[model samples]
Target chain A: MTPLAAPKALDSFFLEARCKILDLAAILDRINRGQGAGAVDNDPRLDKIRKALEVLHDQSGGRAERIQQIFSLDYDPGWDKPKPRY
Target chain B: MYYIDPHIHMISRVTDDYHRMAYAGCVAITEPAFWAGFDRGSVDGFRDYFRHLTEVEPKRAAQFNIRHYSWLCINAKEAENVELSRGVIQMIPEFLNKPNVLGIGEIGLNKNTKNEATVFQEHVDLAMKYHELILIHTPHLEDKYKGTRMIIDMLKQDRRLKPERVLIDHVEEHTVRHALDNGFWCAMTLYPTTKCTPQRAVDIIEMVGTDCIMANSAGDWGKSDPLAVPEMIQEMKRRGHADSVIRKVVYDNPLAFFRQCARWQEWPAETEVEKAKRKPAKAHA
Candidate 1:
């Protein structure tokens, strides 16, 4: 069984989110390149975004499942159930 | 959607981030003194950092129309050097009266070490002596629960320190109750990884109502987002929370907390609010 297959709705949502992240990266790249020759190679803000993109780019094999597991919230349906007599 | 980031490390953030935060309705922010990604050599280093927090950063934030406030302290990570910590603590009072200065904070246990606890109590003593508000930074992951308890125990031991005046930040499911039950304010930090995510923060807020609770980005040199509070607002919206409820968690609550600071002044004056309301609408040509 493939645990990576999300429901159709969530898959669509993740796709749109991925596109927006890439769009942001492109805009940042454009701004960085627009600086021409004098731009300092090390900017904290750009560095952070690059690190975040690297995390995104590294989502291959079982890494995607692991990411989902790390972030998943647990909801107990029977949280309010009456306790059994001991 | 105007909100205040109750705790952020803007010293590590860029000016462009400030512009974006201001545009996104951040009218104010409070930066707590935390580790600068490394250990410094002397008390003079902390003095300079405090000056930047109270002087330079305020001016930079003001350029974007954001009111910047700061808390002064030798963070727990640096508190390991008890000698340097004591020196920095002795010098903090010089900046206590700075208009932008809030109080002594981002002070708490890093590894729950004995030296860290001694320095933590000393900083608390300084805060009590000066009547300054306190902001706490609890340990991360495995240490969080135990460290939060130790910090709380230390705080409880000080009879003069009022619980309400202290904010224990970076609270999670296992620790939020301890802060609130003890009557201290709590903050959930929204980070991309390692700490509470926006959804988890919202869940915690749902489990525990908005009283004495708030959220922050904790945006710093590490991986974080300055716009994380807005992302939490979005999460609240998706979960059917009201605008007023969201505003309470993001805006009103932080304002309420900051008002306790000896130096905090009211922002967005009534006259300014009235002026904005009274302005006539422009017609298209």
Candidate 2:
């Protein structure tokens, strides 16, 4: 019989959290770069990118399932909104 | 290479304190006014104490090449008598703007009484009014945690007070979270018999990290040490804390704190200090 996988150590969750936070940071950078550089969004590909990012940044509680879930996890919807003119 | 005691009571201390602190490589000290040996009876008591703290202790520390900083406030224990303490609080402005007066501090609840709570709120108001940093003195024994929370609530009422500038002193195991979660700087007092031991302080530093954690020798009427700050630093060093971490906790943090004092260096000695007045006030009682 195949041996079961080794049990996780206490730091596994913390390490996972650190990786997730870093991943979020990288995605945010990419989106900001796209906006600042005035990247064209005519392709259907850009729609998929924006949708994915919207979900990931706004998550509430239970763990996300797939990379899509990471994108779909809405934390602060207004976080990426443009500033209002006074 | 050097350490700072962020919350010592040098006015209630002795001459040997200067010698011992110098031996510890204590380059600077911050003395927050607390009970002041006995309950100060009048506003003049505060005036005299402030003069001594600003004018006297600096002279004392200079002999040992130690810089002294003073925090003027009505202590928590004294808060039990709100009427008398209010009289004292009114006089804080006289010296708060004086030289080396780092902040309005060492003020919080004692005995968890209403009188203590009221005085605590009063201190918060005064600190917020002046945009001064606060130095909180938590109650000893059972009231430590409760008093810390009470002080935090009062602080929250005023959005003007920033957590970075406020220092909560004399925290034990149970009192740390309230200080940290509130975003205030955390200070541990190493009193040999009662508050915290040097070894326990090491354990705390290991758990909390050194960003805003500082250790002090809060030696008052209790059995304590003038070298407790250095002893705690030594313990952390022997336990393998980095030199940078030691500097942040002991030197950088206190120096930055004193620098933020509203009028810390403005009030030089009003009284012409007689020659060679660098003797610690062991005999002030």
Candidate 3:
């Protein structure tokens, strides 16, 4: 099976998403660290997943934000309309 | 002149509601994806639903001069089917940046099972990934207590959540404090049949100080009303609560929350032209 790479917009999204996931993993580590190491059901392999999400979030923040500026701009809230004169 | 009902189901409501809302001065709204008492089977079902929520409904409300917005998610009751539900959920981000799609949910527990847990976590991940607000739809009936517990526990795991940005819906007398105590904004649905009532909600606000509490009708196939906010406001007034308190819970709270979304940034206040357009519409209605 071929690994699917993201489109420009989706890549930006995945990048930011990966960052948050890693941040979450860090919190889990902090808790487990304080709980004296045996508190969590640990799998050392999960560290790879955590690191990847962190890297993606950081790298995507720059590129995806630029692409989002070009493609994902939105304007639908009723705020821009002129206020009614009663 | 500004009050936002952050969770109101207008799909089951009427054009009269649009008029009523504008007249009562509804500034904005957020409709969560909720059960309509029947199962919606397939991704196409949710696709059509999300489109209606984002497109058709907002257009209808525009004619009445009310700003409409909503959340995109697989309803929890339907989330019972994990694979089928994820297929629907996976299609959500396609519409996430739509004029109305504020967040990934109205997603939380129903039967408090693992699939509910699985989908809830995925919904949280999507929300965190997108940096969008999460409007969690907690379960109803006796299952609500256990379900809210699961919702909080899972949320505690997700570090991306700010706690304040997570809105837990369908809170009752007992679980209301738990949701607030945990630092999450709590939304109580003022349904006629099964959820919290308006007077009781006021009592809650009185005790809880209306800090992070808000109300919605969440009117669906079951009996409900879109006027639940105004009714609650009137009740709070009748109870002699200060006008500032009334504005906080019924008005300012939701306004502040909806404006946090990047999509609602473009909404403008109604103008003379919009009023001119509204006059003809009211006569027709």
DockQ result, candidate 3: 0.01
Between candidates 1 and 2, the one scoring higher on lDDT is: 1
Give one digit per residue, the lDDT tens place, for model 1 in A8-79: 436636876788778887887778678552464576555555555555767463332233333333323222
Candidate topping TM-score: 1
Q: Chain A TM-scores, one per candidate?
A: 0.43, 0.32, 0.32
- Candidate lDDT values, in order: 0.83, 0.72, 0.73
Worst 10 residues of 2 chain B by lDDT: B267-276
| Cα lDDT for residue B19, candidate 3 | 90
Best to worst by TM-score, what's the order? 1, 3, 2
Which residue pairs in model 1 clash with each other?
none
> What does candidate 3's lDDT look like per residue over B1-285, in tens digits?
357888888888878887988888787777888776788878898889888899999899889767788888887888778897879767888998786688877888787666677777777777877889989887776467667776787787666678878888888766787799999988888888567778667756766677788888786656787878888988776656676778888876777776677776755655887556534454554
Query: Once model 3 is optimally superposed onto the true structure by TM-score, how far is the C-alpha of residue B140 displaced, in angstroms?
Result: 1.1
Better of 1 and 2 by DockQ: 1
Docking quality category of candidate 3 according to DockQ thresholds = incorrect
| Minimal lDDT window, size 10, model 3 chain B | B276-285
